[model samples]
Target: MKIIASTLLCLALAAPAHAAAIAQLKQFVSSTKTLSASFSQTVSSKGKQETASGVMELQRPGKLRWAYSKPFEQLIVGDGNTLWIYDKELAQITKRKQAGALGSSPAALLAGSNAIERDYLLREMGKQGDVEWLAASPKKADNTFESIKMGFSNNQLVEMELGDSFGNQTRIRFSDIKKNPALPAANFSFTPPKGVDLVSE
Candidate 1:
């Protein structure tokens, strides 16, 4: 759970220092009800970098499921209040309160509220290469990440580049996104099965 907790917390926080781009992103997300997308993730920490490809299902107002399929299979689900980490090989289920998952965590930005102006400071950086970019920094500092940059392609969020307090950076790019659909209810909630290990984080 330590690996999942620490590795994921850094990947989720929402902090932006820019505005105009945030508005476009906000409207796109806020207006949409549900989103399902596959992602290419690159996580860097302690000067080391690794990449993983995964699928994500997000429901607005606080629910997300991040399923990783590369290198190894893993699933992390957040049910508004509780966070669950499930491991395939070990058949292990780890649980924790959502508060601890607060490092610019994906949900802090993705599911909670799309209105960046409501909780984050937005900075419009215009464009970077083929993507339009926005910098966002949260109004609170009790979280882990210092800042994050979100990249848009034709008004939709295509990628998120993050910067943490330790100077570690991670970039997650989403593609093949589909919106407004039914996602399994189980994907957002966790019920530890019997006989498997249950660790509290």
Candidate 2:
């Protein structure tokens, strides 16, 4: 689960890119204020495969809610200043400062707090079928993923691939994406449920 969060944060940081691709990414980021999507995630590592399905919601200026519904129930929410991870079966909630949790991570891009041009080297991978692909590598040495590739269809993000140093790959496919949806304030706010042990780090 932690690895999953880290992978997402890594997506927020990207390096430089070609002129047209850069312009497209910039426009996509700027014009998008709120996004909601249903996603299917596949993680392949060491000849094994695991999959999960979830719904995600994101608001600009550092707010997101990720709820996992299949195989298990878990929630990860970031509300600008804090991040909360709640495990339903374990009945535990782990809380961390958002700054320490997201520092230099590409997740900041989703929050509208980080600029892609400043953090990642972006390259146009050209088109694959109906999707236009862009590859981004982090400028920092401490990044977790080896590289990140994003696929956009008609200016809508539909796929992402994250490769780690250990040859593990996580691919996420998005469907039913609603761009600039009117997400309520409560979606990003979380309070630990009763009987749950709250751990702060």
Candidate 3:
């Protein structure tokens, strides 16, 4: 759970080669104002792997909800201003400023209002079958991720791989993605559960 939690921020990196890949990525970013998808996530480290499945919803300019239901239950919400992480089994909720939590993370690239080109250097990593790949590295020096690779098929984002300096990798596959969906404001809002410990940062 901690691996997933920590790598959530790493879910955002790239270089250039195929002009088509970059174009497709830019198109997806520019056209996708809101999105919803079912995701399967894998985190790998030192020959071990952990997997989880969940649904995600997000609106551009900073708002997202990630609800995990497999292996355990956890919720991560970014309500424009604040980021909240709720661990159901432990009965604890952790919070921090949204901007501070995201920085140049992949979540920022996906849900943030900022121009992606300004914060990341995009590179084309060629194609893997039908999926065109692009890589990104944060322009910021203090970013947590070492790099990020995204795969797009038919100009739609379908996969993401994130790497960190510690040799850990997280891979996420999105399916049944609905672009420009009308997401409810409630999805992005959070209220700490009664009797749960609240840790604010």
Q: Per-prediction RMSD in angstroms? A: 4.5, 3.9, 3.5
| Model 1, CA-based lDDT | 0.69
Candidate 3 lDDT over 1-201, as tens digits, reads: 254455452121122333366786676666677888888889998999999888888888798888888878999999999999998988999999989988888888878865989999999988889988889999988898898898877656778899877888989988877878788889999999799999999
| Cα lDDT over the full model 3 | 0.80
Q: Considering summed lDDT, which 10 consecutive residues are worst modelled in model 2?
A: 9-18
* Per-model TM-score on C-alpha atoms: 0.83, 0.87, 0.92
Model 1: ten consecutive residues of lowest lDDT: 9-18
Which rank order by lDDT, best down to worst?
3, 2, 1
lDDT, residue 27, model 3 = 65
In candidate 3, what residue range of length 10 has the lowest lDDT sum? 9-18
Best by lDDT: 3
In Å, residue 133's CA in model 1 sits off its true spot by: 0.3
